[model samples]
Target: MGTGTGRMASVLRGACMVGTMVLLAACTRHGHEGYARYRTNCGICHHGGEGMKGEIPPVSGRVDKIASTPEGKQYLMHVLLNGLNGPLQIDGVRYNFSMPPFRAHLSDEEIASILTYLATRGDTRPAPVFRAADVAAERAHPMTTTMVAEERRRLDAIHPLP
Candidate 1:
C-alpha cells in the first residue's frame, strides 16, 4: 500500500501491468497449439497425462528428465517423429503397444513445438530446447516404429529414464 493517493495509483498501475503480463504469458503457453495439438494427438491415450493401463505411456510429468540428456532427447525425437512400436517398459511396468507416428501428419516445427511443450510444461520460466532444425536433423534418419523402439532400448541400456 502507498501512503499518498498519487503513490497508491502508481503502485496499482504497476501491479496491474504485472498481472496482465503474467496472465498473457500463461495464456500464450497453455492455450498455444503445442498444448492443443498435444491434447489432440496424445491426451486420448495418455488420459490426463497418465498411461492407459500400461498400454499408452503417459506424456506429462515424465519428460523433464528425458529431455535433459543428449541420448534421451534423440530417443524422444525419434519416438515422436517415427512413432514407437513393439514392447516398452516404464517405471518397472511392461507396455506392449504401438505409438502412432506423426511424421506424415505434422511438420518438423509442429513436432518440435510439441516436444518443447512436453519438456517445458512443468517449467515455470520455460526455455524450449527442441527446435524445427533439431527435428529436421533427426528427420534425415527416418526410422520405422520398431527401429525407434530399438533406439529407446539402446538409450535405456546406456541411460535409464525415470
Candidate 2:
C-alpha cells in the first residue's frame, strides 16, 4: 500500500507539471503568435529588435511611443506595408538602409501582429495595438519605398522624436 501511494503521488506531480505548462502556454499564445510572425518576417532585418548600430533602427525601445499617436501609428503601418528608403535618424544615429516592402508576402493580419509585437517590446507606456483593419486602410493607398520616405519626412516634421 505504501509503495502504491508513493507511485500515485509521483504520477500526480507529473500531471500537475504538465497542466501548469499547458496553462502557461495558453496564456502566452497570442503573444507567442505575434513573436513568431516577427521572427519569420522582420527578424532578418531587425535582428530580434537589437538591430545593428548605424544600420537597422532598433524598434524594441522606440516603437511604443511612436505608436501611441495617430499619425505615428499611420506612419508605422505605411512603413511596414510599403517599406522605407533613404537615410533616417533615430536616437541621433543615422541609418541609410533601405527596407523592402512586405505587402507582397504578408497578409494584413500578419503585419498587424508584427507591429503589435514590436510596439509592446521594452515599453513601459501603453501602446495602441495595430489591427487588421488599420493595415487594410493603409493597403488601400499603396506607397512605394520612396513615397514612404517622403511621408516619414512629413510625419517627422510634425512629430519630431525625442
Candidate 3:
C-alpha cells in the first residue's frame, strides 16, 4: 500500500508540473500573437515610420503622443478606420499626407491589440486603451455623408489644436 501511494503521488506531482508548463507556454504564445498581429497589419503603413510616398511622417517614435491624450486617441482611431488626407499636423511638424481609412480591412480587436502594443511599448502612451467603444461604434456606423461629417467634426475637436 505504501509503494502504491508513493507512485500515485509522484504521478500527480508530474502532472501538476506539466500543467504549469503548458500554462506558461500558452501565455508566451499569446504574447507572440499580439506582436505578430501588429507586424502583419500596422507594419505595412506605420512600420518604422516609412510613409508610403515619403509624405507621411514617421510614426514609430510618436506612438506615445498619439496614445496618451483623449484627442490623440480619437484621431488615431479615426485615421485607422477612415484614413486621413490633407495636411496632418503632429508635434508641431506637418505631415502633409493622406492615410486612407482602414475600416473595411481591420477588425476592432486587432486594431485595439496593435494600438495597445504600439502605444504602451513603442509609442509609450502611458494609457493605451483609450478609445475602445469609439473604435467599435465607428466600425459599426455607416460611412455615409452625415455620419462621416459628425465623426470628422468630433475628431477635429478632439485633435490637438495646431
lDDT of 1 by residue, 18-124 (tens): 99999989758754867787888877787667778578777776676787777788888898888988677888888888889888888888887777777765452
Say what the RMSD of model 3 is. 6.2
TM-score: which candidate is best? 2
- Candidate 3 at residue 46, lDDT? 63
lDDT of each: 0.79, 0.84, 0.62
Evaluate model 3: give its lDDT: 0.62
What residue runs in model 3 are displaced by over 4 Å at the alpha carbon? 1-31, 50-54, 122-125, 130-134, 142-162
Worst 10 residues of 3 by lDDT: 142-151
Estimate, for each residue in 1-162, the C-alpha lDDT of model 2 and write its tens digit: 699999999999999999999988863775787899999888988987988989988888777778878888898899889988969998788999989898898999899888887877856456568899989989999999998888878878988852
The TM-score between candidate 1 and the true structure equals: 0.78
> Which of candidates 1 and 2 is the stronger one according to lDDT?
2
Question: How many clashes does the backbone of model 3 have?
Answer: 5
TM-score of each: 0.78, 0.80, 0.59
Which lDDT tens digits does candidate 3 get at residues 45-161?
666444444455665555666556666666567667776565545555666655666678877866666666556555352446534566797677545433443554565576643
In terms of lDDT, which candidate is strongest?
A: 2
